[model samples]
Target: MLRVRQWLFAASFFVCGASLASTACPNFFVNGSNPSIDASLTTRTTEVCHTEYVLLASGVTKGPLYSAQHITAAQVAGADSISRTGSFHQETAIPAADRSQTSDYTNSGFDRGHMTPAGDESTIDSEKESFSMANIVPQDHKLNTGEWAKIEAKVRDLATNLGEVYVVTGPAFDPDNTPTIGKDQVAVPQYTWKAVYEPGKGAAAYLCQNDDSITCDVVSLNDIKTLSGVDPFPALSSSDHANPISLPLP
Candidate 1:
């Protein structure tokens, strides 16, 4: 069923109301509000910004807790003309001890999955930035190339159809027993999620396990918060968080 265990926790870490506009990289978020992570779940995090996306890179996980992007019809059209150059590399801005190196995934079984996909970038520089290890996670090869790819494509299609959309993609780790890869011990997440919000419309999320089973679900924004300990859409109304719109699955 591809289910994620629900964790009951306080919403103390959430940043909302008037303070949203002051969040770092506010432009990439919905209503100018950045996603908030539960304090208990965060550790040694750094905010890394790029031309097309922004992310909260976690030292503990050696990867992004979430990568956020603002997509528009114009950007999507522009991206169509750009060629993907898979130049994955470490994020130099992040402290060396906290950032992931390309060598970590060199012989690892998992793929260097991108949170903000290169296909979403409109310019060559943006596409290159999308390959930063800070915006990556250890993902199952099959899941990354198959279902996850379709999900990314669907989000791009939605942006084209809806004119614009806000997206936040991230990984969810089991706090008690997160697996690791390479000398850096990059945490391998148990699940990966993507939340999408259309201005003046509503929001929804897609949740999938990081396994070869290929199962995934369309869940509410609130469901994502409970599973990930991060509210991807802090500016959305309670009603919007509670109700999830249908999204096509792979």
Candidate 2:
């Protein structure tokens, strides 16, 4: 059936080493556009064997970047157990006063949403490391668990189907109208965007409103830059790609 075919694709991809050439990890910022609102923020980059992540440090919060892994059926089957091993924690690599904490999300009405979902990680250690504060943002509870979550799942599906995929996802803020939560005043993003890319398939970009109501669009990379004010995956921008079709939330 379909499951067998998927497993066969996964096995063949790993066996022939075909995935390695096309799925190289990407850099933190696409074309030198930092995600910080203030000048004082620091940036941190991390490598976890099969994954690469970057933390663009802001005063109270940081933005994280991760490329989705070319996962196998075995990894997918064991993901749940690995994910349960650790909880979110502050990243010690940054100064204590600068990093976000679990306390910052306490009663903040928003969730400590992960830019890189645990599902995309190939190992337990990588999944645990994903809990670092630098990889989180103040996300609306509804959207965090809703359409955004759906998109994360879709990325995983793409990883399985395309053999390899890289995704750039993070928060987008309107500086003039920024919102804050908790005592540390972590900024809540007004919008969030994700761009999914495969070697031969070009790329698809998504934008979500980050609110209770589910409003999102799949748009061109050009549109994504205009809406989010950041250019993601600049190298792939000129690839032959189709425009995004709208998705209506049920």
lDDT score, candidate 1, position 190: 85
Q: On residues 1-250, what C-alpha lDDT tens digit does candidate 1 reach at each position?
A: 4245333232223322322224567899887889877765566878888988999888889999899999999999999998988698889988999988888998899999999999999999889999999999999999999999999999999999999999999987766678999999999998899999988878999988899988778888887787777889998899999999877776
RMSD of each: 3.3, 11.7
- The best candidate by TM-score is 1
The deviation in Å at residue 60 for candidate 1 is 0.9
Per-residue CA lDDT of model 2 for 171-197, tens digit only, reads: 766545777776666778877777765
- Estimate the overall C-alpha local distance difference test score of candidate 1: 0.85
TM, every model: 0.92, 0.72
Q: Give the runs in model 1 whose Cα sits over 4 Å from its true position.
A: 5-22
